[model samples]
Target: MSSDPWETLRAATRARVGLGRAGDGLTTAENLRLAAAHAQARDAVHAPLDVDAVVGALGERAGPVVVSQVADRTEYLQRPDLGRRLASDHGLEAGTWDLALVVADGLSATAVHEHAAAMVDVLLPRLEGWAVAPVVVARQARVALGDEIAEALGARMVLVLIGERPGMSAPDSLGAYLTFDARPGRVDSERNCVSNIRPPDGLTYDAAAEVLVSLMTEAFRLQLTGVRLKDTGAALPSAAG
Candidate 1:
């Protein structure tokens, strides 16, 4: 029998559970790992998003990309309201799409840089025939920012792929939010979120895409999201399977 019960469980998930103690506190190794994760979380929050790289990775498949109203990382963190508006008229063609896809650097630029393009690759194809607006690449953005972007594009729905707040175990997790009838003043309950989207440790791109597609389909038909929309969709098969 293993002395640490968590050792066996740890292999099953990335969650930090059943960590054994050293003396009266965490083991030195555990403490060090925690500190490193904390540092990563902080770095992710302050990291600068490279909009051009994001655009390039996206392969210009959908449409033009644009920034949000948030001027800089500092101001973005300080003024949440600013991130929710459009920086300018550069927002793409309005009133032409059923969905507005937003890729944003929400707390973790690393998460966006790592997963945004891949997730889009999986998601966009699944949403074929649905009018998709330009893929908006926003910097220092919040979840609500997608609402205004969708509103600007006159999209019926806004699918925002942003970085989830960093945690000790998952510092670079990406999250997706889908809202029906997206616009400013919409509350949190009006949106549905698919979170923990980093591969190997969290939901893979394919799985997240599957979940997202299912939700979007339902949201459009029922015209609602958030608590009202249940995520009973099946996850995609593992790459190994």
Candidate 2:
């Protein structure tokens, strides 16, 4: 890995950090950016605000907000349903959004910032008349939060772009999950997930984005998703203008 940091330096260059070669196989720019990102992460960790704070803030309020909260890391973890909907609000019934997209702080906020926006940027224009709800930053949220978000938006399809669990290989990795008519009672297997969302990680942002949009578009046309939607574009209607 050390012998081949040329591509790494290019990516860093696009990210707009100064370039310098550090003795250890990594560019000085690479080390500096990583160090800065780590420092920011540390500060965020030490801050009083976190996924818990985000969830609590949502819980304490009442309105048309889609209730998104962490389920596995705090007091709410025990109550799977609370991690679901806000009992007091239940949110306005989603009437069917053009396209619903949820941005969650699943494993790393940095991941979402780095890749989710780019994926979503290209995806929205591909889908016909898709109007994305404001990108909701979820805290302590889970993979299933996409359903609730879809329900809140009353959307035909829900796609959640979140940070993947950090590994030594890729800390800021991103992932995506797409479901047709996602709701509270839906099963996990009902949705299609696209993971490892970074350049040369698993799928390129643009290509993976095409697949994601294609899945939802297919679902809308065929009225199905999951395995039923895979490689089934032939059965779906042509895209609307």
Candidate 3:
């Protein structure tokens, strides 16, 4: 058995903990690991999303691919507001839809590239009876962009599947944001978010799908999202029961 009491805790999570020290600094191995994690987080932020690959992965489930008004990655980083609007009102046509699905390359393109399609695969099946719009792939996007897209598409609700901001331990974490009666000016309080959705070390695909579906069902019935809504995890069966 390890002498360190924190060893068991450290093994149970990806979090950096119980890292033994060398005099006044982190041990050489710990330092190297930290450097690698930092590099991955930076790369996740800077890397461009592969739109074609995402569309190919989603296949017929995907609709038109779109770009935010930010123009380039550098501008996207500097001007967050631009990312919330579409470049132009093209490809999308107005039609009444029960729900709109948007896949976006937010802060971490790697997250979307790796897990967005799989998430869609798991989520869409759960929304069987709903009139779900084809998935819209967005580049240089922010969470608010889904509002404009869904509004243009005339959807009653919008779900934006995006890459969450990369952290030291979770560079590929995905997130989902849901909004009811979506419009351009909707504030953060008007949305419900399901985050940290990268499996194995994060929320598994099935678990995240359950939460999102439950939120959507309630949002449609309640006609709202955000703070007023709650994910009681009621849709999922209880382990204790």
Candidate 4:
């Protein structure tokens, strides 16, 4: 078993809030104080976001789903090639699935923590024809990593819900990038991204769920996604690109 990034992250949050430490159960006043301090400390980082913690937090649901732990970002950074896929030993899903939701700790863990599961929560129920498997990653992952995930799970489409680098205003925002027939050597524009996924900024989780369903439906009907498929209401995915 791997470490719980959310637990680790929550401890950081509590420490910032003066909650003492993990499992300490701080009082309301302590929480408020910590929140203030956390905010200040976060602001000090010019918008701090912890990608591992965030992605881990988002996958907090109880189910057949399995979440990965914080990977080594050091190797990912020093060897960009290493970040493109999970290890063969990682043992992601082995069988076929209609869709594999690959969660990554991109540049902002907080965003993954806040929005990944919530977004998937709203999306999965609406996808009638889709068989979903959860593949979570740690370290500063990237978009292309989904190709390996698709290959591992034998999935036709790969949707990666990862954290965007935190900005000054939106620190805990998540994003989804969907690619059809996702495998190796696919171009970047070959995918479609539904970004700005936090509340009050972009589409709500429920609404975005519908949009994703619609997009996938169209992709299924037309046998395409990414730049080759046409959205239900919009121009070709190329235009959206």
Candidate 5:
């Protein structure tokens, strides 16, 4: 019953558009939906990481899990610097590897809680020949934390599968960051990111895996990530079909 042409755009994206109003404000349904979304975003920020569940989801191919220097959720949001380092040598396992995969509870733990394992499932089979290290499940972590952990594990590259900052429409959106020659001092420009992984919308799991593996292959070949490397190449053999 809406006359606005923008209503057509609403079907394609989660973004709010051409919402019919009630009096001077949103309709009751819209108001309720907005409130619910706000609540979900708030809860996602404070949600705790289920470490055991995550490791179990990773199944037999898991590795030594670890926590970051960020002591708790409170500190993680307040002091991002702490989240970028390790507290002690707890899960820093010894091994030289081509890649280190870390799953971190970023701003929205809900994302990692839901998508990390599935994303891994998609990417792992494609990386059969690479010397991948144990999957590290880091709690209260930031993207840079993978750098320190990778350095400790003696890995040439690090991929951090993390929870992205939640938007009202996508509270459980997941993200990833890849760094070549990972080390403690690596800057943000040294990493490449792939974001918005979920189901029924956003980036599909299989597609995300394809993009990630492509970037990884390129990074290894060129010894760089971030701005220098782009993900426009043809898919790898495993990614095909």
Candidate 6:
């Protein structure tokens, strides 16, 4: 057995904990590990999303690709507001849709590249009978960008699958934001989010799908999302049963 008691804990999670000290500083190995993690986080943030690969993976499920007003990665980082609006309308046809799905490269393009299309694959099967609009792939996007896209598509609700801001430990966490009555000017409080959705460590694809489906069902029934909406953990199967 190792002398370090934190070994078990360290094996259980990705978080940095119980790192031994060396002369009032982290040990060289720990310092190197932290530096590597930081580099990964930075790379996740700076990496450009491969829009062609994403659209190819999604195939017929994908609609026209779009971009936020932000010109590039540098501008996207500097101006958050620019990522919230469309560059132009893109001539999407208006239709009454129950849901509009958007896949966006947020702070971590790595997350979208790894998980967005896979998430849609799992989610679509559960949404049968609902009129879903084509999946919109967006670049240099923020959560609010989905609102304008969904509104233009005339959807009652919008689900934006975006790359969450990378953490030192988790450089590829995906997040989902759902908004009912989606339109421009919808506040964060008017949305519900499902976050940290990376598999084998974070929420699994199937599990996240279950939670999202439950929220969507309730949202449509109640005609709302956000502060008034609640996830009662009712989607998962009971242990007792």
Q: Give the winner by TM-score.
A: 6
Candidates sorted by TM-score, best first: 6, 3, 5, 1, 4, 2
Ten contiguous residues minimizing lDDT sum, candidate 6: 232-241
Off by over 4 Å in 5: 1-7, 233-241
The models' CA-based lDDT, in order, is 0.85, 0.62, 0.93, 0.65, 0.88, 0.94
Deviation (Å) of 40 in candidate 3: 0.1
Clash-forming residue pairs, model 3: none
Report how far residue 143 has shifted in candidate 2, in Å. 2.1
Candidate with the larger lDDT of 2 and 5: 5
* Clashes (candidate 1): 0
Write the residue-wise lDDT of candidate 2 on 32-64 in tens digits: 777876666543322222444433333422123
Residue 50 error, candidate 2, Å: 8.4
TM-score of each: 0.90, 0.62, 0.96, 0.66, 0.92, 0.97
lDDT of 5 by residue, 166-211 (tens): 9999999999899999988889888999889887677888888888
Q: For residues 116-156, could you state the per-residue lDDT of candidate 4 as single tens digits?
A: 77787777778766677655554446777888778777888
- Residue 73, model 2, lDDT: 45
Query: Candidate 1 on 148-240: residue-level lDDT in tens?
Result: 888888899999999988888777899999999998999999899999999977888988898888898889889888899998856556456
Decoy 5 TM-score against native: 0.92
Off by over 4 Å in 1: 1-5, 89-91, 235-241
Q: Using alpha carbons, what is the TM-score of model 2?
A: 0.62
List residue ranges in candidate 3 displaced over 4 A.
235-241
By descending lDDT, how would the candidates be arranged? 6, 3, 5, 1, 4, 2
- The number of residue pairs in model 5 that clash at the backbone is 0
